[model samples]
Target: MRNVVLGFLGTQLDMGKRRRWRPSISLCQTEGFHVDRFELLYDRKFSRLAHDVRREIERVSPDTEVLLVQMDLDDPWDLQEVYAKLFDFAKDYGFDEDRERYHIHLTTGTHVAQICWFLLSESRHIPAALIQTGPPRGDEEIGTFDLIDLDLGRYDALQQRFDQQTREYGDLLKGGIETRNPAYNALIDRIEQVASISDAPILLMGESGTGKSELAQRIYELKLQRRRVKGRLVQVNCATLRGGGAIATLFGQRRSHTGQPGTERSGLLREADGGVLFLDEIDELGMEEQALLLHALETGRYYPLGSDSEVTSRFQVIAGASRDLATLVAEDRFRLDLLSRLNLWTFRLPALRDRTEDLEANLRFELARAEKILGTRVGFNADAADAWLRFARAPDTPWPGNFRDFGGAILRLCTLAPRGRITRAQVDEEVETLRRRWRMAENDPDARLVGEVTDLTLDPFDVPQLAHVIRICRTAPTISEAGRRLFAASRETRTSRNDADRLRKYLARFDLTWASLHDDT
Candidate 1:
């Protein structure tokens, strides 16, 4: 009897998929049996990719044991995202949840597998050795083979490689962020504090464009570098945590005591054991999860889904939210207890409006960053910078979107700019675009005024609209009567002021006031 190897090929399995899996030469000498059918599952879209892979797997290997090789193209280097997707697929397909039967490989290529494996196993202390015999001296064997149980020194060498690779990636990210960006500096201070001191849960409050994640990453890196924290910094966006398995994902669940049952996958908190768990959009966490989180924070203990055994992991928690948690607590949307626990050291990121002083610096920094990212030299001229400053300082301008908004505006200006330097006109145009979207633009002083301008253009008005309204008001019996008559035409136009102060201001701008008419007499 020949051992039949059933493989369900995913993304990299496609004919065009670039990898070292050259079946023609590699599998040529398999004597007893041949690959019965090679199902090709490939798609550019991710949702379709998973479905296609699953469908083809079922089609090709309906009964025989299948080895799944899943390709997660979303973030090719992100092992966590890839593993989560694979775990979900296994559960959705009712794969036995026990242990040790299925081999699920995530590979971009033969060489990439080792790289991915290195990254994935960096934090874990799994006892294993990978000894690779390079290509034969001659053409006897073209590739490499791995031998298990390497000497202690060799295993340590592999670990050192993992450390080196991890450091290289860190340096790359750090180099990208080393700048005088004021926002970056403020974020650096917060990250430093969070890393150095583990006394309280740090709450980082900022709008969406403020690079909350970057700050978190910096904090994690700095902490690891300074030897303040030992474990990995596990980040989880609460908005993405949804449905029944969310708790299971937060807390590890034991393996089903049957064939090939999936083993317990460590939750982020567990993974971050001695480090910081950065929770982005912490306000969006479900009520139940919030309560569970509160319990953990209070007692410093949590029960993983399948096990009654309480797992104790201590680490600093850094929670980021777009809104103030106090309001959420007031609305009963968030638990006061959790809010209290997380209120240790709260840092609210200044909105772009609040940090207007730093606008010029930020624009220059963002422009350079954008240029680097786009692989082009995009610059701002003196006139363009002046225009942007004027717009940023305009009374009608409200950057509700913050730094992100400015970045987008600059990018648009770059696109509209003739050569490379963005112009004042482009800045104004983008400002108007922002104004319209955010309703921050001052309302055009009434279309009726425009109509009056047109009419005045043809035949000059004997008196301005303000003068006409005052004339109507003067003839009225009382002040109330005057208001009723003057505002009657507004019913059809729906022109009204939400605030009396605004109305007063609008009237003041026209140099017309009740006192002006009274004094005119």
Candidate 2:
């Protein structure tokens, strides 16, 4: 492979007395290094020096070809302009990495230019190693050169700083709460990286009250702080958008059809331009709206309702869904193309039950938030704290509503606490209240698993037992596991202890199957 060196012309150094060696010329004349081509970037004012350096390089290494790249920079010290010029040059340059090994000579350009080159090379925009050339010390005709392969992991200090910054980003996304869940921390870390680098649509999947909406807002704030986005974050709850006016609500209307005055609207998309558009409960969007949204996402332009001209709104999208969009697609309720577009950076936030270890941390966070809102500091006593922790981390806690439920529990505990100190009595009362609420929700046919899966009305006595059975089946890995849990006490009394068979028969009576319940879950 041929070696190609790219650098800027050092006008003052290369134009010095003929005896002194400059970066460009010295790079070409380095011992045991063969430069097949030297692509030298220079301002118009330094054209003469660029040519002189090219001549000297050609004289020292005749086999090397000289390509002068003229960059019109009014001020090389201007970082933005210099970087833009170099970026344009690299983008337009025909790079054949297979046949040519590229090197960026960092010794020739201005400090700003050198910084730009390093950034470009580090980002693989130029796909080259950095080379710094120096003048000869003594008795040597050629200068020395050092090749820097920009492997960031090799730099411990830099890697540590990067890791620290990443942790900070994650913390920012978590509202500065130091959660104890490893999976959750890792998820935040991945989200931090993606949010920093990409403007693609992000799909947040989780059950309701899993903090998807809060996390989406945090992501927008992160981008805003980093200057990745400029406009305000516009959030739309897709479930709330319904009826014939849904399109106009999202895409805006050109004018009032009823001849009413002052009905012009710019829409949420336009308001989100240059920022982030968060669509909470995106799976609830109508089919027509989904199609229009898919079109707007693919092309940053969309026509408003009753308008001939097209309007543009370039924005990053963060979509939150409580339901499985792929399942909706399979059911033909959601647009497959829209799901494809939004699924690029999908992240599923774990439910509160899945992250029980984070219960205490979230409890503290909620308490602090409550203090801010209520204007009074409130916390549980030692016994109450321990009781709350034990109940929260219990396997059967069943945090059906996740963080939303947890936050409500905290708020109520604070409100009921005497003199801002929640005692063991208050904790016991709150726990029982939570249990009663959960039990009621579970027994309510309209909200229970039995209601969701089957349309049949069952005996009042059978509903609660059947609902509990279905809930267990949904969470258990297999029919045998669920049956074992449900029939543990009774199995010893049975002559033939076939738990799975018994469970299957019970489910068959209700026209339900293990596979169907598991899938729905």
Give per-model CA RMSD.
22.3, 16.3
lDDT per residue for candidate 2 within 393-454, as digits (tens), equals 99999888788788878887887789999999988987887786567667575345555555
Per-residue lDDT over 388-411 for candidate 1, one digit per residue giving the tens place of the 0 to 100 score: 788886666667556666776776
Native-referenced Cα lDDT, model 1: 0.57
The pairs that clash in candidate 1 are 96-261, 97-261, 97-262, 98-261
TM-score of each candidate structure, all chains considered together: 0.47, 0.64
Which residue window of length 10 is worst by lDDT in model 1? 450-459
User: Which has the greatest TM-score?
Assistant: 2
Runs off by more than 4 Å, candidate 2: 1-9, 13-154, 445-521
